[model samples]
Target: MLARQLEQFSCIRQARVQLAPQSWQSGAVIVLEPARPEAMPDAAALDRMLDTLALIPDAPDKRHVLVFDTEGRRLYPDHETDETARREQEVALERQALRVLRPLLDGNGRAEVLVSLDEAEKGRTTGRRTISVLLEENAVPETVRPHLESLLGQACALEEGRGDALRICFLPARRNAAALRGLALTFAVLALAGMAAFF
Candidate 1:
């Protein structure tokens, strides 16, 4: 039943609509916005979208990078409280969202996550938080790109005040296991050589 719903949601014709499970709400909802023709999504919406997407069922071999627009309302909604309180809230939300999504974005899913705030609002916001995830490119199979993209797009749309000029990107996961193994072997050999010299 869930699989069929997911498929139907993915087939939605609008380019900017997205669907995903919401961690806070514990329910799936549809987010709608204009196509990528207007302004980009805000920081608050981006954060909410990531929070929602963390609940998706991802494969172990697929890698993903969830980009959040930190300058928009997608991640941090403007509040009347003092700047300190608002900033603290934003940071807390980002940390919690990352903790939940980290496992799904790592390894054969060499996910590279990034949260980018618009340059104009870089230091102006009351609550400021920056989070990034870096993983090898090409982690997930090409077949999954459409599905993931659809999910992300839907997530962006479901939020409040998401614009059409949004620019969300997903990179392919890269393989670096061989490079890591080589480095480990080199370190082991060096340690053994040093021991022999000391004796």
Candidate 2:
């Protein structure tokens, strides 16, 4: 819907709109494939358009720095270095979210347990945190989700938001043990390193 609206504008030859969900409500990305019309909106005009869209939702935003293009040209909240900084911020947010989940995990299973984060929550962790757990075993233990959920249930009360603390979905492993171990190690290195010495 928004993509079509953007194309109708004289400046945009083609507007590809991908609405960014989870982090900021109104967050979106617009890619302009320079129109042949020879009168497309300039970098400055496009920046303003992005800002207007960012505020379109009724909710207050978390001061998003939206990218107008991949050239590291335009950004929101006016001043910033480049897109690399934004990438680093994303890494930081992921780290924080993982930290929030670390305590509930047993971190001792031989199974290649894959802790997953929703792509939307990858940008920001807010409200009730949701995570997926995939056990790289022929049969995932019945205790996995229940144990984790039980831990989370004790971590906070419903009034304190434990009811939505974390949602763990599971899938049985299909790979050979060795491959699963290697994948689990790689994921652990990226997601759980420094999460705890116990891990």
- Clash number for every model? 37, 1
State the lDDT of candidate 1 residue by residue for 1-199, as single tens digits. 2223222333222322122212112322223332342444454544443454445565111112122233222323333434324333433443444454454453546443333222224444321223344434454445654455344334322232322222335554443689989999999999999999999
After superposition, the stretches of candidate 1 with alpha carbons farther than 4 Å from their true spots are 1-108, 116-135, 156-199
lDDT of 1 at 87: 34
Once model 2 is optimally superposed onto the true structure by TM-score, how far is the C-alpha of residue 199 displaced, in angstroms? 70
Scored by lDDT, model 1 comes in at 0.38
What overall lDDT goes with each candidate model?
0.38, 0.45
By TM-score, how accurate is candidate 2? 0.33
lDDT of 2 by residue, 58-101 (tens): 52232443544333244343466433244334333434444445
**Per-prediction RMSD in angstroms?**
17.1, 17.2
Candidate that scores best on lDDT: 2
Error of model 2, residue 71, in angstroms = 5.3
